[model samples]
Target: MIRKLYDVIVVGAGSMGMSAGYELARRGFKTLLIDAFDPPHPLGSHHGEPRLIRHAYGGGAAYVKMALRADKRWLELEEATGEKLLERSGVLNIADPDVYSYEGRFEDAAVHGVSIESLDAQQIHERWSGVRLPDHFRAMYEPNAGYLYSEKCVAAYKKVALQAGATLLTHTFVTNIKPEKSYVTVSTKDDEFMAAKVILSAGAWFKTLEPFVHLPIRAVRKVVGWFEPSGKSFDAGAFPGFTFGNASGGYYGFPSIGGAGVKIGRHDTGVEWRPGEELEPFGTYPEDEDDLRRVLESFLPGAAGKLLRSAVCKYEFTPDDNFIIDTHPEFSSVLLAGGFSGHGFKFSSVVGEMLADQVELGKWGQDVGLFSARRFAQEDN
Candidate 1:
């Protein structure tokens, strides 16, 4: 027997899914959120303590605008829920001139009227003594950017979504998704549930639904670690969240908030992963700590004392490192949101709003043309 659940069913209530569920339910849609594990859990990508939120995105014009919308929505959510989900710690992006470029970011910021301060290596060092950069390095500081308590954000969304009359099923793994002509059936171990519309934001687990919706998304194992700081300057109040880009790769980090130490993670390079497979422990690979340590030692030596703790997460990547936020080609009722690459968490708020907009209005409210899965059609030929 199929239990017709609600107006919409959100699968994989992680960062994007949780926000989507919250938006859908709060807007008076009966929503059901099904998750394999209790959300805000460490098993997925959103568990890491803090994720960066930047406004002057280097990605593109649409990204910058989307980011601004997301920033507004996040603040609104915080105000509505009375939850301290975001921190206005600012963001600093440094790149070696010879190795990389920040021109695209500056252009995007200019086009969007986002404030970005140009800083040379000396200025960066003076502004944040903990940051040690080469004389040739250049930087852009977005004063309005900061970090989000990711897990807390998800938890808050879940709570508010439930209060808004959304049904949540935790620790229940989805076994299958069958999209019919008019409705979709989501099957779990215990029962089959049907909904008129569905939003799929399953992160790495999106692979499991290949039979119902095929997206060119791949999961990659990534790691992040907290390190003991050698000085108080690396504290959240004194230091800003930062990103460093060079010829080798890129790394992102946060200041020590609540004395949790400085959190650091490499933005590029990780092992390809599959669903249901175990992600080796953080230290399983020497580079997990060593790679992060090398960046800290080079730039923020003050924050490179020792490893406080570490965790592994997955990055659902698309072929072009863009995002896949479009409807399933086969089923218009099923909205697909995945392959955020690594910089997706910050936009969860707005992405959720757009997903819900697509369900209710037959199209995304924002200009998500760049994220259309149809862009991959050329590859098929």
Candidate 2:
């Protein structure tokens, strides 16, 4: 019968939306954040026990700016929360010296001005014992790389957001949107509301939600495991996190802390999938765990002991495997933050600032040309 209005109504109260809502409300904007489920749900990305945060991104030089900014924000959040959400455990990329450490690897870091170190197999083994490199594989190590606690981070953000006076409506689904010249209409199951602006950060659902706007984002299912290694197999300090690529494995993992075991997953081989279909069956697929185990068997036999727990989450993928973080061309007031390509969690805080900036100053001060939906202009209606 009536409408509730806000300066900005953010759809999907997950990583991106919650981050945006926190920043917006902190900046004194009237904001509302809505989601179909609770924060840090395994239904979308930013799940599993942890997500990797590496400034030396494998995507390309285009992300150098975003990655660096994200690093700063992560530090800022750490200060804000006083919770140990990020670990500076560092990240290692293990592959044959000739391949993964090629133009893309070294050049991306150089272009982004991020620091890196190349290590021989022996160096990796001696430096980090939990690490198991193949016979001839070398490594490119990024010191700033680390891991993030996905669920805890979301909890931190949600708490900060509510403290800052933002309205967060969980278990609420936004069914549709109607954008007008001066304002936008947002419809949930129980109510209709008007918003001066809208940030469409529905993650996996972004592709279908904005078909009329034409985005290149697609949703893919990713499975990861929290594995309990043999208690005596390796010590925590010896187990530096690593991502391996070769004829054998393309998996990444962490060391056991407080008997948490080594958490591992293969990133490149997620199943083709959609959103919202009883995520349990899709969440813990039999084949996906097997797919990751194959990596453990090849690379780290003693460490990949048994799967203690596992989860399936969806990644919003773009054609270039980068991210799309800008306002929609058709609806300037409607910003889109999707297509994280399975590597968007670490950037959530910075992306929050970017979305907030777009809704405020009109630019995030970072050159995100490569991430613009305009790059997919053929599909960019």
Candidate 3:
């Protein structure tokens, strides 16, 4: 069989890869997107219906700019596709004032010119009666922060990519990637393809590329549960997406949209996962549900009525819990984007743009030093 060639090959047609393929094809680059499974499937991280998007980031001021850029990109995609991808239902970041400080989030908001409101416990209670915060806790509210329809976002990007003349091969597993001095070759079981540039956005399966580009990417298993709300007060129109920071970790949830009930998950509850291992059933671990129930009973009692259903997902975590968007240290023709750490779906739009920029300009068109894989290399020295 003859080998196919292209200007760029994106290995992983999920969130970031699909967006990158769209952007590259829009720019008139001959691009190919290959994936192990058809996306919008429950196999990857981008599944679950909704993902939170917030500009006032508590992660760091470094991320606020990216969040802002992502917000614009999401709106642009919505306009292009004529689809409602984002819902501005607002987001509440609540925590005990003494334990965890909202100072970083506040500073990030101020620096990025993001509008936010500081609310004490009583004020939070009065504004949203469904939420029951302790008198000592406080909250930071961002009116523009909300949830993005994750599945819809990926589908939109894939559709636009196909319309722009990009080729997509789903259910095609990439077995190897070999980077040469002039071009990179990608091999599947049946065929081989060459591309002037390559992008690896393989999410949890990124370790499969360890033979070519070894980055410290770890896959972690996580669970999210849906609970039946007691009343309409927890509906999308009345309630907003929320996160409560605690000593053990943080817990977050979405409002009941379209009578689907409330969906909640723990941010810090994940165990190291190896690829190819069987994923246990969602409710197999009783402690998972019990832990979420404890948080709901304490903070948002009205939203936690009955155990509805549950699902499992994986997060690719870096040692620093930040993203990695740099060229492979040994292969300049290949770029990598992984280690989203469960908070990356919202930034897929801008990240795709950044990856395209790296392919064409040899730089990301912005300062992303914080997310560079070189940080780990430096730490070793």
TM-score of each model, in listed order = 0.98, 0.92, 0.98
| TM-score: model 1 vs. ground truth | 0.98
Clashing residue pairs in candidate 3 (N, C-alpha, C atoms within 3 angstroms): none
Instruction: Give the poorly placed runs of model 3, Cα more than 4 Å off.
Output: none
Taking the candidates one at a time, how many backbone clashes does each contain? Answer: 0, 1, 0
Question: What lDDT does candidate 1 reach at residue 86?
Answer: 90
lDDT of each: 0.90, 0.78, 0.89
User: Candidate order by lDDT, highest to lowest?
Assistant: 1, 3, 2
What's every prediction's RMSD, in angstroms? Answer: 1.2, 2.4, 1.1
Per-residue lDDT over 1-381 for candidate 3, one digit per residue giving the tens place of the 0 to 100 score = 569999999999899999999999999999999999998789889987899999998668668988999999999999999999999999999998778988888888887799999999999989998878778899999999999999999999998999999999999989989888789999999999999999999999988776777778888888988899897998997899988897867888899889888999998858788878887777777877888888988888887788887888998889989899988887888898989988999999999999999887777966688888889989999
Model 1: residue 99 alpha-carbon error in angstroms = 2.2
Candidate 1: segments with Cα more than 4 A from true spot:
none
